[model samples]
Target: MVLASGSPRRKELLNNIGLMFRVQTSEIDEHIDAHASPQDNVMKLALQKATAVANSCDDAIVIGADTVVVLEGQILGKPSDTKEAVEMLQSLQGRVHEVFTGIALVEVRAGNIYRTQERARCTRVWMKPLDRDRMEWYVGTGDPMDKAGAYGIQGIGSILVDQIEGCFFNVMGLSVSLIDEMFKNWGIQVGTKIRSQGV
Candidate 1:
């Protein structure tokens, strides 16, 4: 198995679940299509990443994932700088936002593409009200710059969240339950696989 991303959060999630997978980061242009819906955009990017990596594998299941924060129909990606991070947090405070994560699975056999599957999950998150001081303080920690919506729910940014309405793991980057469901379609039981490995 292969994970087509370099995100430490995703790697850790898989590791914690006892899944043994190699990392093969894909270098694709992650350009969000303005015309596409948030779900479509994420799923498309995920499929692109998985397909790119699966092309080089002889026999492997490549998993790709993409996540984004959407507020009022606008997508908020990673902040480019600390200033932008502060701005993003300022805007998100005291408001409800939706996090969309797309997952794609690409199956390769004999050095050729055989099958592909993709799905998306959404989680509603509410951010706690924040003042400028708090926003700046959080930005100073340098954790928000690399996260969507300028926050990481599983990290220190957990304090910034007031509540959540869906899969908690989706906010972190990948949803293990969703991945397991997808895996079932291929007749691969993740739980059984883990048990077989004595994990």
Candidate 2:
């Protein structure tokens, strides 16, 4: 199996689940479609990454995933710099935002896709009211620079989050439950590796 993302969080999540796979970052652009819903955007990006990697493999299952934070219909991705990171954090300080993660699996054989499966998982996160000093100090730590929505729930950003309603892993950029279901759909199960015939 192969994971087509360079995110350390995603790598850690997969490792925690004991899934043996390799890391292969995809070279596709991460542009979001302004007219599409958040879920649709993620799903499309995930498949784009997965298919890009699958096209180079002869017989392997490649997994591609993309995550984003949505606030009142606006998509917030990784902050480009300190100022943008601070601004994003401030905007999300005391509101509810939706985090969407899309996962795609592609089974390739002889450079052709045999089967494909994809799913999107959403988690609603509510952040506590944050003071300017707190947001600035957190931003100085440089933790939010590479994270979506300018926060990382599994890290120092956890203190800013009041609560979450959905898969915690989804906010971290992957969904174990959703992936398990997708694997089952491909005749693969957690803790066991069994590829169905013709898959």
- Best-fitting candidate, scored by lDDT: 1
For residues 1-199, could you state the per-residue lDDT of candidate 1 as single tens digits? 8999999999999888878789999999999999999999999999999999998899888999999999999999899999889988988999999999999999888898889999999999999999999999999998887788999998789999999999999999999999999989988888576456431
The lDDT of model 1 is 0.92
Tell me the lDDT of model 2 at 23.
89
Clashes of 2: 0
- TM-score per model over all chains: 0.95, 0.95
In terms of lDDT, the poorest run of 10 residues in model 1 is 190-199
Compute the lDDT of residue 148 as modeled in candidate 1. Answer: 86
C-alpha lDDT values of all predictions: 0.92, 0.91
